[model samples]
Target: MSIDFGLIFARMPEILAAFWVTVWIWIVSNVLAVFLGFGVATLRRYGPLWLDLLLRLLVEIIRGTPFLVQLFLLYFGGPFIGLSLDPIPAGLLGMTVYSTAYYSEIFRAGYNAIPVGHIEAAECVGLTRGQIIRRILVPEMTMLVLPQCVNMAILMMKETAILSIITVPELTLVVGAIGSQQYAFVEAMLLLALFYWFLVELSGFLGRIAEARLSKFRFAHS
Candidate 1:
């Protein structure tokens, strides 16, 4: 059977609107995940034993749960706890919480890879803790972890597609609605796939650029 470009083009406005929602949700949740993950990892790495254990427990609990279950708990369960959130904010919160758990693991791995001896050496040279972190730790970890972080970002972007399950009206929901209403499942789904494909390609291209720039020190050493 021939494909119908006309049907797809006719629905472009709604599709584009939904796509933009997906884009923004991905951006917001990713930013939150990266920062929160780093913060939690740092605290767990250097804070007291109690704090470390607590963070570890939290991470494990989050990781053990399914993403959809978490989303439902936040979106549907919020009202029961007197924390009524709109679909978008609830979805954002769920995504942020879920991604943070994984990003924290990535960060923890990066942090652990940096030798304590290097930090000690910096300290012996009379460098302040803050100076040591800024000059030594940050750059080294960025180089070691950029690739994994890029992969996590891509994964987080794909996870945003699931936000549609909560009526967040992202790409999947929009396309699915159009398909159901117009009996154009093939065309609607084809366009949806193309939209996600373009995003994945764009993200991969930019990630490669970032990885190359950030890992220049490694390249130079080799």
Candidate 2:
């Protein structure tokens, strides 16, 4: 039997919605992750020991757990607590928290890449702590942060696949549903894989653009 391209086209809208869901998660989670990660990274670098330890402990806990387990716990277990969530929100929240912890280390490394001498010189010039961080450390670390931040954004896009486990109707979940309903397993999966590959490529392309922009200024990390 010949393949029905027209049938696939007819179902395109559903597929497109799934694709949008995935993109939406990526956008929301990346925004959240950047803020959460930056805050966590700052706490590690500038906050007191007690706050640092608490933040580090949270990071460690997240890093040690598998994403799938975390999703299950949040989706299935959260209702028992006061924090109930719908599929989409729950899935995005899981991805946000997961990305936040991992991205925190990357951002922290960017800050750490700045030289101690630069910070000391800022202090000697009578700049306050906020001034030193804003003018010297952060500016110097921009190049370092750019690559890892983009990479983390791309990684989060891929991680959105796990949301399918919770029936969020994102890309993977839609593909699986359509495949089963249509009995076109191979065809559906191939299309889904192609979609994901395109998404990743697009993200990588944007990252390269950002890297080029950041590379204009040479920050000596050594």
Best by lDDT: 1
- State residue 91's C-alpha deviation in candidate 2, in Å: 1.1
- Global fold similarity of model 1 (TM-score): 0.93
**What's model 1's lDDT at 149?**
86
- Candidate 2: list runs displaced more than 4 Å: 1-6
lDDT of 1 by residue, 57-165 (tens): 9999999998999998888888999989988999899999999999999999988888888888899999997798789887888788889988989988888888899
Q: lDDT at 170 for candidate 2?
A: 95
What tens-digit string does per-residue lDDT give for candidate 2 at 1-222? 555545455688899899899988889898998888988999888889999999999999999999999999999999999889999999988999999999899888888778889899899999999898889877777777888888888888888888999999999998878877787766777777888899899989989987887687866545
**Which whole-number lDDT from 0 to 100 does residue 40 have in model 2?**
92
Q: Rate the local accuracy (lDDT) of all candidates.
A: 0.88, 0.86
